[model samples]
Target: MIKHRFSAFLLSALLLSTGVMAAQPDNVIRPVRGTIDSVKGNAVTITTRQGEKLEVALTNNTKVNSVSEAKISDIKPDSFIGTAAVQQADGSLKALEVHVFDPSLRGSGEGFNPFESADGNVNTMTNGTVGKLVNSHGRTMTVKVKDQQKTVIVPDDVPVVLIAPGSRNLLQPGTKVVLHGAKDDKGQWVVRGISAGKDGLTPPM
Candidate 1:
């Protein structure tokens, strides 16, 4: 049993781990079971019969439907819900999942957001000095990151949400970041997300 001062939901699977006496950062593999105590903007507050309360965060990925595919209503204070709760480092009950008739809030690992779910591995990545974008071809460009002019294959899956220097989104000989959409002949590198410093169009060599 993870020794928690409060009676929040804890994962049964991980409470009994050996060698580790402290509760895992997140071992609640399954969702917590409880009743909806309150409903907030993307998050819902649920309270179990034992007076344990938890707040669950929901995104597009959360499964909020029920087995019958019917939406839950009322969400009575005493209704039963299978829930998974975690005591966050900040000492808050984090609802892993909530089961209700409507089930419009099943935890999809941690809820869902389209922009966030689009690419899990993609983050705001930056290369040193940020190379200048030089138009090598139509709608295609190339530039050396930082200082090295080493030939690096641009990836297509990247999402260049923003470009450095300005919002022109134009790829020119002096453009710091080569933000163009073109695939390599071998079809391996695809330049999608690249950022340049906030200084100017051309990066310092």
Candidate 2:
């Protein structure tokens, strides 16, 4: 059941990353990506990419996941993965980043959905099992989501990473992270899940 819970958390995180907001004004959830400035007790100071400094508090229920650098070779025919991609003129999707999920979290977020990047580019997020791989021209693969499938072209320069369960110990200063949460009544950020970089690797998606 732990894997199921983790999958749910990943789906929630992905939704926040895609800029989805709650209909209720009081329950607005968003994603924040930045570098850690400091950590004190349960509070974390983050320096946003825009040069803004924000302090967020982590609760006992906050989930932590580590993202580490990975290679395209790690993706096999049956590997479950998620990729943010832009649709090309030819109707094929070009990957911006590819993240390989842990085996236990195979079906997390499993489907194609519209996505907007931090820079305002509209894309799509595909999370599913790999059906086939073709290396001609570039690395291309067929991703199956339920009965639906998408063809994604992964460029040689696209970032590839792996996600795994992590802990508070990975919350050190200087690390890059993507936080999914909302602000509380006190106007303080309340973190729900933290996707932290490991070994100097940054969370690409």
Candidate 3:
């Protein structure tokens, strides 16, 4: 009986050391928005809009994309896009900004969720395909995400931009960036994708 108890205790210790008995960390991809403070080798330090500093690691497989200004005419039927909007008093969505995604990024973030803006305002982000366009009270359109649909109005003063493939050279200090990444086992932020502003344009989306 003594020998059997020793064997059971040894097995439990081995499992604990290998993390088999430990709770797994959350690996869900979350957005991090900040301005680059410095770039050294494979790591980038940033100061978040909330004034917290964080260091994010970049792997060779990390994707870097850039956003540039686009016109409202760029949006059409069948376009895949994402927009940040606020709910109006009448139950409609008024667009704060519109971002047209590259074809390769179709269906990215494909749903509605609450978005916290840099200035602390709460908005909604809708990513989907354009179903129809109507020039009613404004540039109103129907956006469909899977089976659900949302009606959004793009006002004349709202910023619209296009997101496309970019190079890592865009990750310069002092530039604004938004990245989606997950924490690794070592508690390091591993970037899956990052979007940087181009030509002094802030990535509004």
Candidate 4:
């Protein structure tokens, strides 16, 4: 009877360990963007451009950065850029926002991946170069990102921005922030890091 009890206990422990590991989040590659509605203690509330409200908990490990305004003319040929775009039915990407990386920041977070878009539609992040540009009808540019090329439509209203190092003090009401984090075991959003734009600058990536 003792041997059977010991076997049962071992099985239970194994199950518990498995559950613990499953509860923890894996690597975070999803992107979160919105306006800071409020900041209270270790929690921050944000309203996305799509009007979805998100309250993410902050931890001591959260990294923060600031962003500044940029111009579309700044994007030259071979200029490395990261943009979050929504795929359209016509097989083109509509630029939600664009981030022009400095020469020193080239190749940072390079690749295409699924992102948490503000509109709740499937979105992707493309990090690459401006292969070609056209002036007819707003702005059309062909971007070579990763191993693929996407024709991006840059509307007149899209905001372009530049990235700069920032601090936690940037987390104030009305500030724009792009968050990257994971959900905890309780299904609560926990921030790993944040990029808050300064003076109305939006974090495009």
Reference-based TM-score of each model: 0.22, 0.79, 0.79, 0.65
Model 3 per-residue lDDT tens digits across residues 1-205: 9999999888767654642113223322236788899999999998876677889999989999899989998888999999888988987789999999989888877998777555557677889999889965559999998888999999888899998889989999988998877668987778889999988777886
Model 3 spans with C-alpha error above 4 angstroms: 1-30
Candidate 2 pairs with clashing backbones:
none
Q: In model 4, what are the clashing residue pairs, if there are any?
A: none
Comparing candidate 1 with candidate 2, which one achieves the higher lDDT?
Answer: 2
Model 4 weakest 10-residue run by lDDT:
19-28
Q: 1-205, model 2: which lDDT tens digit per residue?
A: 9999999887777764643222222222235778999999999999876677888899999989899999888877999999888889988889999999988777876888776555556577788998899876658999998988888999888889998889999999999998888768876678988999999777887
Query: Order of candidates by TM-score, top first?
Result: 2, 3, 4, 1
**Model 1 misplacement above 4 A:** 1-30, 69-205
What range of 10 consecutive residues in model 1 has the weakest lDDT sum? 112-121
RMSD of each: 25.1, 9.6, 9.0, 8.6
lDDT scores of the candidates, listed in order: 0.28, 0.82, 0.82, 0.77
Superior by lDDT: candidate 2 or candidate 4: 2
Model 3 root mean square deviation, Cα atoms: 9.0
Clashes of 4: 0
| Residue-wise C-alpha lDDT for candidate 4, range 119-176, written one tens digit per residue | 5555787788888988666568998877889899988788888765578888999898
Model 1, 67: alpha-carbon shift in Å?
2.7
Task: Give per-candidate clash totals.
Answer: 34, 0, 0, 0
